[model samples]
Target: MTDYYGILGVDRDTSFDEIKKVYRKLAREFHPDVNPDPKASDKFKEITTAYEILSDPEKRQRYDLGGDPFSQFSGGQNFGFGDIMDAFFGGGGGNRGPRARMRAGQDALIRVELDLAEACFGAERELNLETAVACEKCSGSGCAPGTKPNVCAICKGRGETQQVTRSIIGQVMTSRPCAACQGYGSVISDACNECAGDGRVRSRKSIPIKIPAGVETGNRIQMSGAGEVGPGGGPAGDIYVEIVELPHDFLVRDGNDLHISIVIPMTSAALGTKVSVETLDGSREVAIKSGFISGETIILKDLGMNKLRGHGRGNLIVHVEVTTPNKLNKEQEELLKSLAKSRGESQDDVEIHHRGGAHSSGFFGRFRDAFNR
Candidate 1:
């Protein structure tokens, strides 16, 4: 296998932060998005994979023990270090060459939409997923029970072969895996029919997932070891459950706070009234003060969504909008006119005048004044 340090173009003594910095720089330079060259893209992927493994302590430990992290390791199934090296770098030949089988398929993502109540209160979901599972016929092995695979004679079990290339200065050296044996240094003569000489098959599975309370949109619930079965009878990867919160009919969310707009009649704004507010739990009576103005907010403490990773709930802000009566009956109009007459004396014309100011007239002057203010 390529040295993680070498792949990252850093020294073995480099710190974790230094390693990350170097990886980011190299990734930016060689990323497929920035560099269209196929070779650069492949190299970028290789380096990124190497950095991902090395930066993680658990994966790095496994790699240090000569283990192929991408392959399955449980149940005595193992991958040769040579095969890992050949898989990343081409098997010492011009051809892509045979590669070792991998285990623990890969993690998958699925989106689930939940209402605000469900996101706050939590719920159980039954997921129908189609993934690769181990074959039952040969017990995860490609060979039948009685017979086993034979050693490959092409690469002599080394899984790779050396090549000599002519260069201007001298002979160049390269290595690749033997095509016949596929880097396993062995071939299954009587392969199992169930898995078609591989070790896994596609099957449908139903799993129950309990979404935790206080989960928000874009939050992921990881189901450990629930992913696809690895190649060659390896362990399974994890499955990530992505949450997508549905929009509520009456409320909009901000962090954990719930904002709602409530419409009240003009009479209700003048005369205090108790309103029945709907909530996830049930309904509650909220009192509106007399002489309430439009665009005013009433805060209901601890009535919002629960904190995703903390204790206590957020406040619910209710914005009030007073609806004015557009069409008034004769009696209503007469009563309003009487009320206005009692408030003050009526006048025919009222003249308003503005004192002269530097920006009171011109457009640009007003614009500049607006910005300065």
Candidate 2:
């Protein structure tokens, strides 16, 4: 006797629910249509037979008692049409008729590069792509200029055929897609030469797309009906435009905020000055406060990228980097030396500034002091 439980990889005392679950998983895995392995058909049959006997209460009882229940049926007993149909169709009862030749097209994706300014503000651009488009010669029909498709005689326009097979379980009837018309219920006479009867041709097309404001890298914009046309000239799918932001020369974007660094002379920082900065909107003047230090950040509100799908805008952050004079003339050196002596200090004796009454020393400490001020 064959052990149905072992075949299904389950315990002998397993419940019906568990056995059904295992059978379904194994059946789908080993089904001939899903798994192309040469032995898959035989394995599927084995799993089906095991499930059939174990799932029936009477058959299971007889099998558990070491009796073959199938032996009780004589050769004179005949299987009903519904029983045979159920065995082949899995209880679907009837056929589903012909399938449609034309189907909805598939969506496509392409990446486009955008400048930082273009991403900050909305823009319209043209894109070129190669995809399947409807054939102009046949007007989206698979037939030639003068002829049309005709009904298939083999399937009588039903697109399927019935067959009977004798197996160990008895005679079973099944229906399969007809080969004559390829399940389309019709055959094209004199197929279109331009599209090879598929009703579509591969061609390059240019389309205009609108990019909204504040679009960042990795953002996707959907363009409807811009994808490949279906095989039989069906509906066109959507084309997704993926945004790739190009590196900016002066700005670094983080979310909706923009950051930039600028260098100012030590004298300009101490005396206060105004400098022109190239922003996304345009060139604007930014004021440097007196006694400005390196690493100090100045925020310009509403000067950054626009908020995506929102109303407000982000701020532009400016980091000040004070530039020290690399070369000094003798007169300049003398003047600096005199100024330092007047402040009660020498070039060798560096003054350490305290912040919030906290005494700290080093480059990092000076950086912290700069920001603290």
Predicted candidate 2 versus true structure: per-residue lDDT over 1-373, tens digit per residue: 7887788888867787677767767865764323445466467657766776676667668878898845433210111011212233344545577655554567898898999999999787888888888676765556676566677889988889889999999999998999998887777767989998887899998877789999998999875556877766555677789999998877878788887778899999989999998788888899998999766778899999999999999989887889988799999999888988997897787888656433234533554454444
* Top lDDT model: 2
lDDT of 1 by residue, 1-373 (tens): 7787788888766776777777667765664323435466467657766776666666677877888755432311221111222233333555444444544467789898999999887888988989888776654556655555676788876667779999998999888876777677677888878898777789998878888788999999976567777676544666789999998877777788887777899889989898988777677789999998766678899989988878988878776778988799999988877865786644455355655553234533443344344
Please list the C-alpha lDDT of all candidates, in the order they appear. Answer: 0.69, 0.73
The deviation in Å at residue 81 for candidate 2 is 42
Q: Candidate 1, 298: how far from true, in Å?
A: 1.4
Candidate 1: clashing residue pairs, number: 12
RMSD of each: 13.3, 19.8
Cα TM-score per model: 0.66, 0.62
- Runs of candidate 1 with Cα error greater than 4 angstroms are 1-100, 345-373
